[model samples]
Target: MIIADLHPGLPFFLGALVVLVTPLRYRWIPLLLTPLLGFINLMGWELGTTTELTFLGFTLNPVRVDRLSYLFGILFHIAAFLGILFSLHLKDRMQHIAGLCYAGSAIGAVFAGDLLTLFIFWELLALTSSLLIFARREPRAFRSGTRYLIFQVGSGVLLLAGTIVYFNDSSSLLFEHIGLTSTAGWLIFLAFGIKSAFPLLHNWLTDAYPEATPTGTVFLSAFTTKVAVYALARGFPGTELLIYIGVTMTCFPIFYAVIENDLRRVLAYSMINQIGFMICGIGIGTELAINGAISHAFNDVIFKSLLMMTMGAVLFRTGKINGSDLGGLYKSMPKTAAFCLIGAASISAFPLFSGFVSKSMVMAAALEEGYHWVWIGLLFASAGVFHHAGIKIPFFAFFSHDAGIRVKEAPTNMLFAMGLAALLCIGIGSYPWILYDLLPFPVSYLPFDNTHVIAQLQLLFFSALAFVWLKLSGIYPPELRSINLDFEWVYRKLVPTQFSNLVSAYQRFAEIAHRLWVYSSRRLEVAGRRLHGPDGQLSKTWMTGSMIVIVLLTLSAVLLKNLL
Candidate 1:
């Protein structure tokens, strides 16, 4: 039986079961078990069993299990396994349960047959993943987690709303080709956009990622954005607007990253840069482009997680993640330094690395599609990746300015996890077909062509040369202590500050008005009392019994005279 043929409901059930039975002491057990369960489900699925079903008025089918979703699903499972292994030292059961559920939901989502199924898993990812951020228990972490949840859950809501509109307009909930001209389609696109770290909507990433626990960052890096990329590919492939958005997403983050002091936050920027490539590929919408996007997603999960693991390990040991306070640690942690370098090389698209195999596909597709400007933007971002993530991360963290803090190597589990990921990075880079065969489309394009290899080498080598020149000439910006603001500044500072000022002004105006109203009303009440009192002019009366009798006698005489 093919793995995609297995019921999508099974993973959710098994994941929930794991959450229930796994104890706090062995919380990591569930995290470890989840991927195995996914693997089992994968093995049990048959291509023929891929079918669609409607339940609770929501159409769901595990219909598509082609190479694209398959590659992502398999990588997600692998990432979960590695992430769980790295996080074994974490005792937070909430993080453990949430991580498992989040990973499982991501897997389920990739295999989902329709929009409704995707939305269910999508929302679940938001809920569960936010818990990982909150697990840090820091005030910043709590606050950022709330923001993160809002953005994530908001994406799901948009997706749900779009699904409703789609069903209302089209009278169908089947997840198939969706055009961007309709309301429902745009809603879905925005929904995926939020997850894909679209410009302006992306602050949730840099805002929240660095706030997660050391181990939590490793897990955070792999799932959320990749899932969004997958959803975009599934729902909005070939949407032209994405090309511009993708370009913006890639270019603008580099400035902030260059100035960022937090190494993890810098990686967060690079994450967006990488996603831009994938988005560009999807926008191109050719078979090769789509295949490139999926393949890059596979490579990204591995190397990006590997990079995060290095940072996580460093933080785990030293409790410091700021780039300014770190340097020259490669002397003490040579193994870590080596692992980080491998990750850095892979991210930089060095020849014989995973990134070289995967990222070049997108560039190739762009050039093939005659998207010259798009290709140029991606090229510059690729160089920028080498600057911020490929070099800056490892350099500042391990080899730049010695902060004179000597820390021990990462714990055993952490090292093992990093080692495993590093080995895979090299393995995949050495033999591209190991991953190429699993892409959604047939493997017709090769990453190792002589022309492609020479061009990539030239691009990367020149970028490395630029970095060296900048560093040696003291032209590189020094990492600073103060936070450099981004889109989150709008929510974090600007909006709130404006709102508070408005409320304060309103409160002052309300108080003055209330006082004046009270004074005027009291004066009116006193005047009213005086006029309506018993001794007032309106209350005086003058009726005597004798006068009444005289008047009655006169009236009687007049009445008798008139009658006669």
Candidate 2:
């Protein structure tokens, strides 16, 4: 009977439609309560629960509960609640609707027992989340939103194509481990890779996140890619290719984040770096590795949201987000600055932070699994991430030279949301087992061993020292007013420019062809007129004598031919 009830995530989807009719004054009730109800609904289901239906001649499992999906369901509900709480001051009904639907789609996707069910939610996630970007109501935002939609929708298309191939090949649609040896598997893997923001497939994130409205960025940071991560952890764990791809993801983004001027864009790049750690863990595929990967994902969504909220608060209060334009806001927004430092510490994997607990497991797993080079690369990436994201973000945005900008602190609701996130960061860091207990596999490893702690601390200390040395010696990259080109340049600039040139070239060729055609046509017309006109030689009276001579010559020629 309980199986007959609506899906846990359906409440949020239904809440989205309800948002339209709800009065503006009372909107927060549903915004806050929807996720709560969804969370409660998820709690009611037992592990191993199954719900089936017949759709289009196939028995479809729309809901299948297990540890993995349950963990993500809880994580998503928490993220949704925090995001809604942070946006309490917003009056934009469309954003509220979009955020709810987007969160619901992610929740639905993780619970989907069939690829077809997942595909439906996958496309919905793209459509709903793009609305947040478009909510900015600016031309630049619109363009960025369009580009974002292309990547997200393109990802869904790949999933659909891959699903069709996979189903045809296997005659089954269960969402389960699908190793990458078949055409369908590879196609699906690529689909997940695009959503995971893997390497060159990543520009959409940096292009879109900063362009979204402040609160919208917080929502944007939570769901889409993490869902892809879930898909990877579920379907392609232990794939060797992921290790190389993940390490590359970790290293390359550090360069971009270091030079990026927009604080939010830096965070966007940082996000890729964080995801790299998880991907690498999933690649390792030990019990410790999978636990580490998903747990990191859990911590990342929270801490990253905290960081985004701080930046959003800055933008909300001061109308500026570029590092070049912001500085010494600690004077007014001290609480925000404090919260930001916690976020920085958490993301940087400081010994007493959330990242430290989960990130170490992945590294330990790598070492145990004999991926020496991978472990080394991950170590380097850890140092690099702290250098840019950890040091650069807080230092420039809050504690750098005074830009002479004074602004009020973020609103109370924003602070409350951020404060809650900060507490979770500390709580999880201090007692990681609380989170560890919820992992799909039993977590038996301890993060606070003396040897590991000392090493991590040394890594952090030296990284800080190097940052200081660079800054004091004037070698550090300065915050500046400029645009840095990334891979998106290929499409945003190169492709478009070349396309314009092609159009111009075609126009020129068409002009020349038209001119030649007109000239030749006129010449033929003139010749026709001359030959047919009354004044022309062929049309004169002499034609009668010429005709008689021509007939005699023809007859003489015919007789000569016959004699021969």
Candidate 3:
């Protein structure tokens, strides 16, 4: 196929195979060019372009280029490039191959116009990304990758099941708005929810992200959940339930993130918090709200990946990531420290940062929709995010008391990736209109008004003040060498423990029941032998003579009665 006519995601997949054979010295050629070529292919199409095929008597649209999908396609391309760039130093080819395939799968999913097509890529997404986690080459990564796969594959299973039911009910496989009016919608919504890290089903992200290799976590953060966000925006916009779910997602994670010791895991919690904003905007379902969500997703990929990259660099250099263990690194890794602060400011939604321009739109939409309570909840979440992710992450990792640990700064390749991301964060923050134009809807919302700016600054300022006060007073939660539990404790610990006990009890009951059954069976067999066995009582030759005498007497009596 010609470059313009080829599928946008195909290059990455095809390049992955090529990467397998390329020598280590020359592998960068394909690793970098794949996403670049994919982006060029993606750019060749106009809106509403589609490619179709027939499979198993079903007409499928495997390639659909429209405004929404186009936005995500562009975002994924940028993310893929950044990820590949970040991981260029790794000697492990498996990580390289997995990252490319996983990126390709996410891009394919974004362009899919049919549920089946979407499902095909959805599963590829799960399988390929799992390999990245497993690339860590450790027991924890293996176990965590298993858990991650279960959730991701479970999502695909739900999607397939829902697609079947929806097709049976509607006779359509088109991917479009599906409100929660039927079983199919609910099933599909749930599938999106699990991947989206809905409140109770969220532990997989926190558990698995920290265990992956540094570069692996960067890839993990960018794709899977964001794809879920895209799906939800397309499939379940304006779902009232999502507003509340998103609120909970934003609020609950703050507490955990504040107390969590692992720096990367804190970012994981922070991720849920940011996604909550996107979910809320999508739930609002206004044009501005949808635009805000997509724009934020775009901004988030760059900034979040930047943050993960900085942490990864730290882990690579110092062999430590815990807040308690990392401190005063700014002395040696000043460039990395600077990049980390930019990411923190962006995530915290500081004025003139990437987050400021997009986050406000969602809050504005909430207010415009008269969901005052939801607006208030989102506002509170914004402050909490600043507390944990914004200030806490940078403060502890790079600025706290000296841990007496010294190491070289991050490598050149890692610094370049972080620099690129940092520039985007600033560029987008400076020119929100560029991103606003890329949104699915027409753009008119302004994020830099005096009131909005002042209000946001006040909230962030107070949040930071409170953090400082708490820390000075020694009331802030100390970083400790202990396990903190979340809802997963039920499944991870309590459920298994209880299940084992139940199995033991059932085994004992079965043993007793088996003995009683054997005893009763033996008794029944003996009784049956006594009653009907050959040569037993009343089974001899006397039976024939007695029978003949009884028959003769009965016949005489009957004849006498009849004559009378």
**Cα-based lDDT for every prediction:** 0.85, 0.93, 0.92
Residue range 1-564, candidate 3, lDDT tens digits: 268888778989999999999999999999999998888888888899988989999989999999999999999999999999999999899999999999999999999999999999999999999998899889988988998999999999999999999999999999999989999999999999999999999999999988899999999999999999999999999998999998889999999999898999999999999999999999999998898888989999989999999999999999999988999999989999999999999999999999999999999999999999999999999999999989988898899899888999998989999999999999999888888888899988888889999999999999999999999999988887565899889988999999999999999999999999999999998877776668556455567878899999999999999999
Q: Per model, how many backbone clashes are there?
A: 6, 0, 0
**TM-score against truth, every candidate:** 0.91, 0.97, 0.91
Worst 10 residues of 1 by lDDT: 1-10
Write the residue-wise lDDT of candidate 1 on 202-260 in tens digits.
99999999999888888889999999998888778898888788878888898788899
Ranking by lDDT: 2, 3, 1
Q: What is candidate 2's local distance difference test score?
A: 0.93
Model 1, TM vs. native: 0.91
Better of 2 and 3 by lDDT: 2
Task: For candidate 2, give the lDDT of residue 311.
Answer: 96
